[model samples]
Target: MTLLSEFQQTQLPASYANLDPATLTQHIQAAKAQLGSKLLLLAHHYQKDEIVAQADFVGDSLQLAQLAAKNHQADYIVFCGVHFMAETADMLTAADQQVILPDLNAGCSMADMANMYQVTAAWQAIQARYPDEVMPVTYVNSSAAVKAFVGEHGGVIVTSGNAEKVLQWAFTQKQRLFFLPDQHLGRNTAYQLGVPLEQMVLWDPTQGQFKGQADQATRIILWEGWCAVHQQFNVAQIKALRVQDPAIKIIVHPECAYEVVQAADVVGSTHKIMTTVQQSPQATHWAVGTDHNLVQRMQATLPQKIDFINPIACACMTMNRIKLPHLAWCLDQLVAGQVPNQIKVDPETTEKSLSALQRMLMLS
Candidate 1:
């Protein structure tokens, strides 16, 4: 369904617009009770606490998609994450099952950075230069079209947890790798693999050229795109946290800048960050660099012995857009037998994108 018209028709009824926390909770719980196993809620870790508390499964994009793929009994999958995530669930699940996004505007800035047009142009330029020596490796935080592009080019998709493995596999197939949508992730993964800074070049899609020397020796071509949220966690923030409490350990997502990642005591995905904090020693303090919601959630759920703080309080505004009202409204629609903001990828794109996703799952 069209995002604009669908949202217009299914916008939270005026009475539910300013619902109190208790009332909203009741409505959501009632709907869940009514739908039972027919409805499955998938929430990303970055989602607000209220939304996450109601989720049947909470994880990163790939993990959520995997959960949807495995659940054959749920007729409706309500994804309380960004648009691309719902699109991914739609791509991975059976045709009879429907995936709905709580908010159509909940789109990732990093994903938007590398559209099909820009990617196609960049691919053409790179192919002209390196022929078949280059392989495209897109981060999972990208659009379905971008993933399909990678699949069509015999490339694979990678997540933060499996980035190193995927990159290693890519290098085995080609002399050069074009990492997309997030420059920091590409650079960090390549650096860990012994790829020198000099050999890695940054490709500015807007400028349509490489920032550094584009010699034949260039091994990793990084796209000049990054998560607005993770980019806020800089080296200064880490240093400030260290100054305040020298004992506090700093952990961050790999999407942060090279300097930020380098400064972090630990680097991992959102799930990894959560697991680390959960398993840490008692009385240990942590300065996390990721979405604010996740850090806040960890502080609420983890043991009191483990203290958590944000290196920088940065929230992914897009992710935050999926609030309680949006979720309540979406659930009401589902209970009423109406599917609003349903995400459906075209058949061809789903097939090709699934190929890239399956490759990552198999290799990871």
Candidate 2:
């Protein structure tokens, strides 16, 4: 329940460092057996194979949060993802349920880009210029505070899987849509909806001004933020893949740059990318552009039928912070009736953020 600043000193015991991988795994399994259904461990797709192997449920942030929210039997929810994700689970779950993050330092850089102060200032400035004309839409990767801001302003939250649908719905409600903490996603989604490139303007939070043409009747105002991992995959990588194998299909997450997404043979969320690979023709080759861990998982899962390669070597370092040692330590603490790194959003923030989350769940 403490603020992130107050809980800055999240340190594990020195004894955890001395435990071997086998011992750590054994301890984790033992703790799980002891807690049984009362403990729920959630891992994001970007998490390492070891962490995912230990998770009771594995999916994207929204999927994990929805699972945590609906689980009435779980007393403890340990999220093996970034800080924002754990904060989201806290917002969605019942008041009696507790959510924990394995590492306090695991935070999304994109989410950190658009803090509440910058967002509040931008909202006020935009509204001052065009009152009641803008509808805010934040990606699920953002902090709970940003989601609360969107909800309080009559906006909705969206995930990569349902961004296009949610944006389409937003366009019907307001004259302009303001997407936060991920410019690439906003631009890619807006462009897919037939919004002209010239009509979209980038709002640079650091500069505190619009980057593109300000007078072209902007329909989508994209905040100047992006995923560090996805941005590494560029059009050049796709070009190289095409040169290597004309038959190879390139699939990328929508978080990639507009040019990269446009060049990709298929553009979708992580789930869609995985599904595409699963349903593809046997012995097909694929070049994937997303978190390296997820692609590695797919490669391992479909080893016999498909050959998967990372178009670029990139991984979300924040997600990778939740290693075996951290997981084992967290589970040990939970089993011993101690909750370390518990993530709890303020009551007011949770109330407002849930409104946006609920709206997205209904629409998606």
Candidate 3:
């Protein structure tokens, strides 16, 4: 396992360029069958249908990471998700197990928005101003370095599904909480827990400060970052859907804006969204605001008339990087005893990151 910083090149070979879809699928399936129990293919829900079809397990980022950690038989954990997710799997899984991302370039935009330097500076400024214990809570959609920082500072990692539970626990330990990466999720979860909007503030990493007067009264400081996919859905889309058919129920991910979430009939994690749509047999019409791939998947497989709130909403470009050709090429390399795009976190980073993750696990 090579660290990301030491990773040099992992571009897909030109041999796969002309391969037809059927050929690619055959190659992927063959490699899987050959690898057998030695391989565990994990795909995030945001992945395209073809990728999901080849996955041994299809779930959200955290769910996939947890699955990777539990599968001890698999020597290779091929994660068909973004870079951050792969990094997480590597951190959680046994040191002997290698985690691979099909495409080296598949990275989360939200994770890139906040880095170690910016987070360190923000913590310093907040401590200097507030004179209170400020707890750090990072979303799973963040870099391992950020998670390490949180862990070193005695904080816990959180996901959309367990954010409320973790945040409540954080508040019990500290006077203030600094949420990393995704502002919408932090704000939405805190609001649901009865934290007033006035008590929550926004932190601007670019400016090296908070957006407003984030004083001692500020209980929650949200980092200025969001998911490019979920941010596309707005209140107007909900209104249009309502006007088109009042019977249409709007289910959305918590990553959407607060206004959009408020207008939504149901708000949850990606797993929750899938379960809600599948279990609600009485609801026929539905509008989902999240990644386009997952919504499109539901539309095709589910009995309900499901639609993406914003049809024009761009698919997760990073997740789309893991195409059928890329998967085929990756698996073929593995068959040849060559590892490509393997994600490996350094020892210090992995240890610290696991501290935060384990804290979350304990709470859960």
What TM-score do all the candidates reach, one by one?
0.95, 0.96, 0.97
Candidate 1 lDDT for residue 237: 68
Candidate with more favorable, higher TM-score: 2 or 3:
3
Comparing 2 with 3 on lDDT, the higher-scoring candidate is 3
TM-score of 2: 0.96
lDDT: the better of candidates 1 and 2: 2
Best by lDDT: 3
Candidate numbers, best lDDT first, in rank order: 3, 2, 1
Tell me how far the alpha carbon of residue 163 in candidate 1 is from the true structure, in angstroms, after superposition: 1.0
How many steric clashes between backbone atoms does each model show? 0, 0, 0
Candidate 2: tens digits of C-alpha lDDT, residues 1-364:
2246656446878898788989999999999999999999999999999999999899986577678778888999999999888888888889999989989988889988998878988888788877889999999989888899999989999999899999999999999999998999999999999999989988889978878676638898899999998878777767877898888888889998999998988999988988888988767888888888888788788852333334446688888888898999999998888889988889998998889999988887
Model 1, 28-91: lDDT tens digits are 9999999999999999999888889999988986688678878899999999988778877888
Q: Model 3, range 1-364, lDDT digits (tens) per residue?
A: 2235667657677889789999999999999999999999999999999999999999986688678777888999999998888999999889899989888888899988988889999999888977667889999999889999999989999988888888999899998889989999999999998999999999999998789777667889999999999889999989999999988999999999999999999999999999998998746799999998888888889999988799998998988988999999999999999998888899999998898998877776
List ranges where model 1 is wrong by over 4 Å.
1-9, 304-312
